[model samples]
Target: MSEPFSLLMAVYRGDHPVHFQKAFTSSVAGQTRRPDQVVLVQDGPVSPGLEGAIEHALADSPAPVLHHRIERNVGLADALAQGLRLSDHDIVARMDADDISLPERFAAQLPAIEGGLDLVGTGMLEFLDDDGSIVGRRVPRTGQAEIERYARFHDPFSHPTVVYRRSAVEHAGGYRPLGLMEDYWLFARMIHAGARVGNLAEPLVMYRVGDGAYARRGGRAQWRSELALQRAFRRIGFTTRGQYLRNVAVRGGYRFVPEPVRKAAYRRFIARGERARRSTRIAR
Candidate 1:
């Protein structure tokens, strides 16, 4: 039998009640293999409607829910680190506040962990609206070597689709406050620390793409974060000076480009193996 796992998620006042409810239901109540427990961290204050939504969704959860509240917003990395500690199970699965995890999301991931992988993640489809039609697909390299190679350039795993061992993650120093690149930074450290990792080729999460998503990928703040990431990667010898310079030109340069150009580059390279845009309507 697969080991028990905790489903971890975080929510702030910015999260919409309706979207949170959907995310909660699909990732927990609607899953074929339900989690052993739910660890929810409220990053900050939430509205009454959102509180109501959380209460209703907890009612539908298959497993008991463990809750945490941060008096102030501490960002995703810090909030998630707290939830990770609160999780009783060694195996932990991550879910975004607005993404829809397919029913079989953990069905494959958990067993792969049992099979010895320290971390495993799956591909995801991006949706623009709540209508369920997929706008794009992001599939990372599936093989072990492919993942190791890809990590040098981009994030090798889809964050929301990740299921990982707590010990492996903690050994890598857990999540740090790394601006928007927290997930990327953590995965890089895990790889460098010799943690076994892999990816599922099949898409298991419907990631909600919000407005200004491309623009958000650029701007001064993003550039700063990208610089910090490249520096950190180089300092740890995870990346060579040559690789670091190249990333600054390619990935770092991605931060200041115009939104239209950034969007083009993202779909062309970052999306990886995307067959154009898949408009297939995903069903529950």
Candidate 2:
């Protein structure tokens, strides 16, 4: 028999009606090798209609769904931690309720895990509409050393697009609440601990960006959060310039540049930066 891969999903009231169910269903239905078990932690009581949505979605799934319902909301990191604790497979992966996974996502990641990478993340496409339509692609550069180097400056791996070895996450003490920077905190710990991380450089998920409970906060609040992340990055050794670039990427880059050029430019700049790092490494 083949080994089982555990997919841990954290769902909450933040998920819009039917959004999480669609994501969950898509994950299972689209996978090349179905996960051994899917552990979903419902962060809190969602809308009354949500249960029906989940039930209808899971009824037809190929994999078994293990649902954990929490009475109160404890934020994202805590919810993820609880879900991770419930995962009992060699491999672990994350999925957001509002996102859609490509069929080959797990297939692409399994090789990375088997290749000895502690965490394997893939590129993502963003959807502006509620349905599974791609608006823009978030392409991440591949390779372990390059991923680490880029992570020092910015979050090279999108959170929802990652599949990780369970051991590495345990080594990092699981996820922690850091407001808007929780994923950043965990990823940094994984990198600093010498965990072998890599990116697939392919869009394996459709992430629904700038929506849900957090969407109403407007640009100024987001700017403040970015500033907070910049401050947090300082504590972790990211240069002031890197922090500034991240700010620009989130605040200015997305808003100003047209979709056609922005992502292409982002890819080019990231590739250029990685090459520059390689040069520095050889020089040293």
Q: What is the C-alpha RMSD of each candidate to the true structure, in Å?
A: 4.0, 5.4
Model 2 over residues 79-137: C-alpha lDDT tens digits? 88888888888688888888888888888788778878888888777777645565566
Worst 10 residues of 2 by lDDT: 211-220
Per-prediction count of colliding residue pairs? 0, 0
Q: Which sections of candidate 1 miss by over 4 Å?
A: 270-272, 275-284
Model 2 residue 152 CA deviation in Å:
1.9
TM-score of each: 0.94, 0.79
- How well is each residue in 1-284 modelled by candidate 1, as lDDT tens digits? 66889999999998999899989999888899999999999998899999899888878778899979899999999999999999999999999889999999889788899999999999888998646677888876776887898799888998999999999999999999987999999999999999999988789999998888888899889999999999999999999899999998998887888899888877887354754223222321
Q: Can you give the lDDT of residue 247 in candidate 2?
A: 64
**Model 2 bad stretches (over 4 Å):** 130-133, 209-224, 227-231, 236-284
Q: Pick the candidate with the highest lDDT.
A: 1
